[model samples]
Target: MTAAILADALTQKVHQTEIDKELQALKEQAMVSGTEDSILVNKRQGAADLLGSLRLPHKRDEEWQFTDLSELKAIDFVAAGKVSLDVAAAENFYLPEAHQSRLVFINGFFTPELSNTNDLPSAITCQSWTNLAAHQREQLANYLGQKTDGNEVFSNLNTAGMTDSGVVWIPANIELKSPIHLLFLTVVDPTPIMVQPRLLVVVENNAQVTIAESYGAITTNCTDRPQQQPYFNNIVSEIYLGENAQVTHIRNQRDSGDSFHIATTAIAQGKQSRYQLIDVNLGAKLSRHNLQMAQRGEGTQTEFLALTTLAGRQVSDTHSTIALNHPHGVTNQLHKCIVDEYAQAVFSGKVLVPQAAQLTNAQQLNRNLVLSSKARINTKPELQITADNVKCSHGATISQLEADEVFYLRSRGLNDYDARHLLIDAFAGEILDQIPLASLQGRLRQCISCRTI
Candidate 1:
């Protein structure tokens, strides 16, 4: 063999060894946590078997070219142990809008004391996997870890180590007036650890509901600290919308800057169903989110709005794919990113319209604002269309804050800082304003101000 070929083989061997070691450590952690359900045990074993063959994503891969995982690979992380928090302290993470309709998980373990699902309507069932009845567990075995194709390694890793999940079920023809919140909080640990949190939501035919999913850290001041230790949070969420059902999903991620977060959200829409998503990402040392939507029936409609804000040396990446498999499908997506300092942001959005998807209308756009010369943004908006009668378009834009607009704002009696912030707010507001909750919008606006200023 040539010298280069020999080196490549050696590198592959080393990578495989590392992956095996990590998987074994995670499996040990899962054993410590323990699983009571047979379904969970079978799923975990299957995932573990698959994870052994898959290696960590490398820069050589097309999907992970711009995002680096070396920092994550360097740490030896064990599974997180059960951490408890005072009810009063956990209340700090609750939202006023979902005060009575929230489900809380700490370090991937369901904490019933910190959760409130008592005020929900009778048609809605919100509980954790550990609390599910036998019939319910049997029914859920068909949906959990079944939405995605199971090609991504991080997602499979989550399934392999997952101990519990937050489940939401809405019966047919039911409409909820309030939103349900799923709060997953990670506490700073002295030793590096990993947590896998899972969620599943099923809305039956003609049912309507709104979901608020959030991931954050439990800090003394509710902010990143200098002594914060590094940890890993791997999460997966699956949502199924039945025929004619309507569901609105809001997801927010604000982990500690010293932590690593990887998440996947898989959504399936049935005939004439309407699904909308508003995703906001703000904090993490390194973060990646995979958002996938599949149309299971004809005449389905989907709307996606995403906003990402980064400062310091944080790295954030978002990959979204919308598959139109049936006829008369409609999809619209808008993603915006604001990067400052030495931070980097990456976005790759793909819209697939096959021959069966006639009369499909899809629009995708990605806009980015770079504050410093060193800050970087990598964006790719792609549309793969085979149907001739489809209307599809995808585009991306990357530019600094327009000097002309900033100057005009300054000329209107605004100082330099105020002028710059105004322009940034306007740019981000286009997506943030569409969020359903007023309190969340206000909080996000403040977070943007703090990061940009």
Candidate 2:
């Protein structure tokens, strides 16, 4: 009996390792991949240690109760550090509006030759962290990894192995005439790859700028076989707006269907600032986005709009939070999801108004349209307000394409597919029209219309 008990104890110890062996391998990779004596070494090491000490969240966790990570447990992924890409293959993915002001990263490492920064104004600074000098990196030490908390485990994992980073700093009182775009493209490799992309956008007081971050792959045919393994993309974006700054941010993700994407956007708004966000998701076998924003000062205006379009057996989850801590705060948010076939989607949004946040006007709405009977949607809109003088409202709606509307379109010389596509396009156009760039808006409309079920 004593011998059996000792054997069981040893087995349990191995089973209870904080992170899986796959993640442990990544931690080891972080230790040896980057420069050893750089200014960011300590920060990377600290995040690595934190990642090593904590376990990945499971379905039992309240925040992740609706999403499952069991499928991720089946694969072994190696860190994709300092990899190269074919420039010709990556040329088509760059957006035209940001042609002269863009940064491109291949396999999470910034590619200088493919990026264009020659036309940027003197007041604006746009460069990859990999190309910065030691002193320049030191100047950024105080701002890096400062806004996120311990609850962001995936972000910590990303920081542990992240070697490529992009930075956009706008000087005070300077407004950029064009937007800056960050494009990250992943290529397939024989071994399963894990890529981490980090970005920091800082707009100084009285400055204004438009920024966009996009993630995708060179090809969309990664297989599960050992020779053509899948990939995982973990991205984190930190946007800081100084007092009176007006910023417009856009996030676009269209990865391969065989990939896994986990992204987080943390925004900090200063006094009397205005921040707007447009989030679009189109492809991924499994994807989750955590959007957190804080109104730290009075008279701030915040707006968030998200649209997710999925088909086949895809699964997508979006969780957002708006924390108003000051008086006279205002916010508006709207999220929409379009699911077809056997796909599933989840939307959870929360608005927090503390006692000090009197006279806050906030509204949250979630709308979902399911085309197939097998599709599933789980939505929750919550408002936690402690202020007596606040005007807050939250609601959700789940519905399908009405047959009568389809029939009306069909009678007007449109086929079944065209009719269905028209309805879906109208549904998505509400958010797509919010985009200021005509090129991007047209591209989104074409993508939605072509992917019609």
lDDT of each: 0.85, 0.80
Tens digit of lDDT per residue, candidate 2, span 53-115?
556678899888888877765566666756677777877677788888999988888888889
Residues 294-407, candidate 1: write the lDDT tens digits.
999999999999999999998999999999999999999999999999999999999999999999999999999999999999999999999989888889999998889888
- TM-scores, each model vs. reference: 0.92, 0.90
lDDT accuracy of residue 264 in candidate 2: 84
Model 1 residue 197 distance off true place after TM-score fit, in angstroms: 0.6
For candidate 2, the TM-score is 0.90
Off by over 4 Å in 2: 1-38, 220-229
Q: For this target, which candidate reaches the highest TM-score against the unseen true structure?
A: 1
Ten contiguous residues minimizing lDDT sum, candidate 2? 1-10
Largest lDDT belongs to which candidate?
A: 1
